[model samples]
Target: MDFSVRTVRADEWERARDIRLAALQDPAAPIAFLETYEGASAQPDSFWRERTEGGSESGGGRVRQFVAETSDGRWVGTVSVLVERPSDEVRFGAPAKVDQTHLVGVFVRPEARGTGVIDALFRAAVDWSWTLPEPAIQRVRLYVHEDNARAAAFYRRFGFVATGETVAMPGDESAFEIEYELPRPEAGA
Candidate 1:
């Protein structure tokens, strides 16, 4: 169960694609992710390549993707953070009201779920968010489908609190995705 967590490299597109497809196959995919397996699978290699590169280290500071890889080189988990500036177009939910990062594309293999890989991935993501220069990240936020209790529980355990904001789930107006946030820690704390 030994694994290391690190930002994904620009050249790791195939590995990124594989892990993302696997996540879309997980039973929780219906609630955990906005992308469908069918949709993702239909994308061409070029699409994946561009998407992966945009989230990798070469993507500049706007986005970052972190992966947990076993000693044998199997990527088992991933989380992506997208920097959101107040003037940036919103990717989901409401437009950013402050400088922040949105956590998305979270996944951990079933076998790696309880091995602390998730915690490590999240730590790297949030820690990286706080380190972004200029404007300063005021918070790290994510949206969870209301029906996804397991994910909500874990977010709460990780110190994210519900922001009293709800947005209609895309393509399903009746359902809601609740916003959760962890504010930046007080300076010198």
Candidate 2:
């Protein structure tokens, strides 16, 4: 399938909501995402609007959501990045000790698995993270549920390594999420 990955626009909030709802329905949603389908689907239109706006291409460099859209306009995958700064309050897990990007909200439709759509989406997201102005991001990181082998394998193949850090799942203390990191490439290499 032919697809192009690009940062979502602020006006495409409805599309963003639709894709998120679809993601929450995926089998891995329970461990892969922090929210449930029921919880997210219950949100009002304004909530989605604000979410998309905050993650849109013009979100003042705080966040960016990349979407993989097919030739016919269907969205098949998405990945979002949230910029983390040392002085900024932590949103999840722990406070940032240095400038970094947190990868989150990753989802690719079931049918699109192994189709390279994910690779395309990550290219857009990682490229965006590296291009930020002064205080360039030192790395990009994400948390994967310890039991999510599929996701962990993919992250490893994509060059992310475990950082020996783990955090208890927000609402489920019995399980933990492990941290993975991909340090920034050296200058000119």
In candidate 2, position 174 carries an lDDT of 100
Q: Return the lDDT, model 2, position 161.
A: 97
Candidate 1 lDDT, 5-98, residue by residue in tens = 9998888888999999999999999988899999999999998888889988888879999999999999989999999999998899889999
Q: Candidate 1: lDDT over CA atoms? A: 0.94
Model 2 agreement with the true structure over 45-84: per-residue lDDT tens digits:
9999899989986778699999999999999999999999
The candidate scoring highest on TM-score is 1
Estimated TM-score per prediction? Answer: 0.98, 0.98
Colliding residue pairs in candidate 1: none
RMSD of each: 0.7, 0.8
Error of 1 at 38 (Å): 0.6
lDDT of 2: 0.93
The list of candidate 1 runs beyond 4 A from truth reads none
